[model samples]
Target: MKHRHILLVGASFSGAVIGRELAEAGHRVTVAEARSHVAGNCHTERDPETGVMVHIYGPHIFHTDDVEVWAYVNRFAQFRPYTNRVKITARGQVFSLPVNLHTINQFFGSTMRPDAARAFIAERSDTSITDPQTFEEQALRFIGRELYETFFKGYTAKQWGRHPHDLPASILKRLPVRFSYDDNYFSHEFQGMPAHGYTALVQTMLDHPNIEVVLNTTIDQAAASGYDHVFYSGPIDAWFGHALGRLAYRTLDFHRFSCEGDYQGCAVMNYADKDIPWTRITEHKHLSPWESHEGSVLYREHPRECGPGDIPYYPIRLVTEKQMLAEYVERAQAVRGITFVGRLGTYRYLDMDVTVREALDTARHYLACLERGTAMPAFTTSPL
Candidate 1:
């Protein structure tokens, strides 16, 4: 295979993983990260004030059932065992997340078994609404209005910056209601956090001699023209400069504050009440349970509309955004010598493990295309 110099627009997992795979294949990889750091949103740094490893973007727990992805990440960084047991403060009461049996029993002040609780929830659910359209309707159909309002209602509205009625029903499918007392936020068989934080893991991936990481550089499509192939991980709409229309996204504002000793006692504590300004307070120290820290650092996460100069967190793919995305994707297809990858590139929210999986698959797909003597398509994975 002829060695080709490939330009990756972002140095996050999407770019770093792809770079590593390609570099090992005798290809020169250039990873251009707009931010000063290599890890995009999964960036973690040691807090100078408290000596705690703070997730600069937010808390990211690696959890996935994909054995390949789990083993692949472990090769870069040693991972410590972790289970994300989320706690939610709803109506001044602390309850385990995923609306488990313990939470249901505690909420109603009744001792109910798994079968009884399941039946109870069924009775409470609105069977009248045969077809649930919006998020509110979906929650009511499955978990009933009481549980929906108590937990999902306020949090969903705050996270998306839109009313539940306007949101899609698919949004509510992520959260599961378990009859068992299992409070584990995710059911993935493989789950852990990188021992030295995500940044270290990414830095290790880009350590190959064939790979060069360019920090604080915004490499647009025009700038990437010199490369044989450009794996653009930046926003798909951004590549074309939003010629059709700007896709909607939700950005987060983190208010950092420190306190002596353990603050929340847990890694993540979500404020389920709408009255609370912030969505969740993440205690960084708790994230690294093995490490000892006298002082605790936390981030009060606030989600709002993504403006021109904001770091886009979640893509709000509403009806209008989807329509706009179709136009941008069409433009992306017509382009040559470029392939869009990653969450922002695809215009969707993705977990860290999924990002890694897709990155690995994309690299393999590109290699297969090259061997077959075929033109590499604009996108290895479908954005839609």
Candidate 2:
């Protein structure tokens, strides 16, 4: 097979994987990242002040049931087993998240077993709404008013800068209310953080003789035409200059502080109260329990409406936004020589492991298409 000139726009997880796969297949790959660094939001590095490995963008806990993805990343960087135990401060009391058996028992002052707890929750749950439409209805139907108000209502409002009623029901689909005492945030078979950090893993992925990386460089549509094929991991709407209306997105404002000792007892603490401006507080030192630091660094994560200058963190895929996305997808389908991959490109929230798994699948699909002499897919559902 003849080698092709592949241009990957964005040095994110998807781009890095695609670039590596294409290069290994004897294709000349050029990766251009608008940011100075690789690994997009999963970027992590050692703190200069405290010497603790910190997630510069946000906390990224790698968790997935896909063994293939686990093995693939492990080849690049050693992963340290880390389970996220999140605590929420609500109604002037700290409570374990996921509404586990302990949480239910403590909240109701009952010494009920897992089975009893489940029964108790079922009894307490509001059954008035048969067909749940919005996030508010979904939460109310499952956990009822008190628990929803204390835990989700305020947090959802703050996170999206909108009421829970405005959000779609699908957003609450994965919300777990465990009848057992488990407080683990994720139920994935494999869960951990990269020992050195995500940045190192990405650096390894991009380390190829045939792959050339250009950082702090933005590529426009005109530039993309030069390459044989283009892989875009940026926002799909933005790529087309938002011909359809701009999709709504929620961005975060992080306030960082350095302290002499530990401020929060745990790695993550959720402020569920409506009055609190920030959503959660994350301590960098706690992320790597293997290492200890004399001084600690913390970030107060505040969710805000994404503006023109703000960094887009999460897409607000409401009814209107989804309609707008459909229009953009139509435009994307009409375009050729461009493949959209990753969360931003597909406009969906994704975990670290899922991102890697999807990238791998995308690469394999691309190769299969070339081998069969067929047109490549415009978008990979697994990534979005």
C-alpha RMSD for every candidate: 0.7, 1.3
Give one digit per residue, the lDDT tens place, for model 1 in 177-266: 999999999999999999999999999999999999999999876698889999988999888987887788999999999999888889
Q: Which regions of candidate 1 deviate over 4 angstroms?
A: none
Off by over 4 Å in 2: 382-384
Q: Please report the candidate that would top TM-score against the real structure.
A: 1
lDDT string, candidate 2, 208-309, tens digits: 999999999988898788788899999888899878867889999889998998897889999998899999999988888878899998899999888876
Clashing pairs in 1: none
Q: Cα lDDT for residue 74, model 1?
A: 98
